[model samples]
Target: MTTTAPLPDAAPANWVDRYAPAWSRPWLRLGRFDRPTGIWLLMLPGWQGIALAGAMAGRAPDWKLLVEFFVGAALMRAAGCAYNDIVDRDFDAKVARTAGRPIPAGQIKVWQAWAFVALCCLISLGVLLTMGPLAIGLGAGSLALVAAYPFMKRITWWPQAWLGLTFNWGALLGFAAATGVIEAPALLLYAGGIFWTLGYDTIYAIQDLEDDALAGVKSSARRLGAGAPRAVAMFYAVAVALALAAAWTADLSLFFTPGLALYATLLWLQARRVKIDQPRLALVLFKSNTWAGLILFVGLAAGAGRV
Candidate 1:
């Protein structure tokens, strides 16, 4: 039996290590199920869209929709991780932080990773089918973005921008699912999510700056270099602005302003606290976006109350 150790980037004492059968550990890790942050980040945009639409409808968020999105997000994020690992296996092998990933470390074969992607996608499709036609179409349209994302670093200095677009597709899907049509507020929320991903993922990229430089990978962190913190602040500011605009476009009440303010303050603190040299702190700030996003969701929901 192959005894798989946790990868360097995995959360310590993650559930996979404690509960997963030994044979399943490699597969679980390959999907990044152990790192729940990515899953949460990916899932939040969808929830935000749902909440925003619900707010516009003057009702509490639809818990059923939330549950559906939770499952869909987890499965899709896992599939995305597997596909990215498959595509970046060579790059992963050269980067210190990513070298221990299942594929690069030889814990899982390339073929198995593909099979896992198929399995996850099939399950996600089941969930997608449960939604309306518009949501399904939006979800299907996202495949092209996902397919192109892994290669963005090889061709552009702004892979994070591509990621911003790809990661926030849920904002569109969630709104369409709830409202049966895409609208301006959803577009605004999607744009806000793109900036949010750009900011946090840049912080995440900071952890890999040295390794990425050596590997010939381009990232906003490397491009911004010493000014990365300021750039993150700028990106986060745009995200907050766009999100506030989205709420206003939805005609959310004044109650949403406080949440937006808190969200902005948190992003400001992250910018002030960021030190590119501190990989641990970078990871902390990157993960902190999860809470920050949740705050924004709460604000959007509160503001959506009956005007």
Candidate 2:
């Protein structure tokens, strides 16, 4: 029997299972609404962009912009998840960890999944249109990356790096939306966010290393093998350095330094403690990046205030 129980990666009592109507459960599952970490991770870069732009302006980020990005992020992330599931339905069926997904478990049909993707993207487009011309153009351009991301794992060993590009596109868009122009700091933040994704997504991929190998999937975790923790540390180090450079370029005050320090420490702890063999431990460490992102946002906002 196909169980409606929470999937392995989702929290035991996630809202999708707890509150979503039975008829809507499959659609919600397709979007990963139950696993909110992905949503946070995807949204943080945009938040950072807005915060960084606020620092550049020596003012606070616009609350309306935050609300817009928040709604937009959730919609786009849901679209991305549905599209990925559509593309990977066969592969998902073969993997133990993903076999229970709605599509693989026969809870949702492929045509229905595609229709859901279209609906989510259409809604997200309305939010995207609220931004300035530059941001609107950049937001539209990101669709190509989103469309191509699902095939990256099949074609390259470094699909995580591709994810870094696709996921961090919002950093650029947010900056453009806030400032009406892309500047050096936004570029730096975009670059830094790529490395950040590299580090965290590598950690996330650790949970699937065994299954990915059996399924012939490629990932940084499988590429780095047992050296993943050290490599993650290196990636985090580069990310911190680039972020500091972004702060410097934006003229954010020294107050940003301490937050950077704390952010670095968190990444260090994750790198030092994560066990490639322990999928649960890997997941815990992966989720910790939300705090890291928040610390950076606070640093940027405070630094801007003092400046």
TM for every model, in the order presented, reads 0.98, 0.97
* Residue 96 lDDT (model 1): 84
Off by over 4 Å in 1: none
Name the TM-score of candidate 1.
Answer: 0.98
lDDT score, candidate 2, position 80: 97
Clashes of each: 0, 0
- Per-residue lDDT of candidate 1, residues 275-307 (tens digit): 989998999999898999889888878976654
What is the overall TM-score of model 2 with all chains considered together?
A: 0.97
Candidate 1 has an lDDT of 0.91
- Model 1 lowest lDDT segment of ten: 1-10
Model 1 root mean square deviation, Cα atoms: 1.0
Task: Give the winner by lDDT.
Answer: 1
Model 2 ranges off by over 4 Å: 1-3
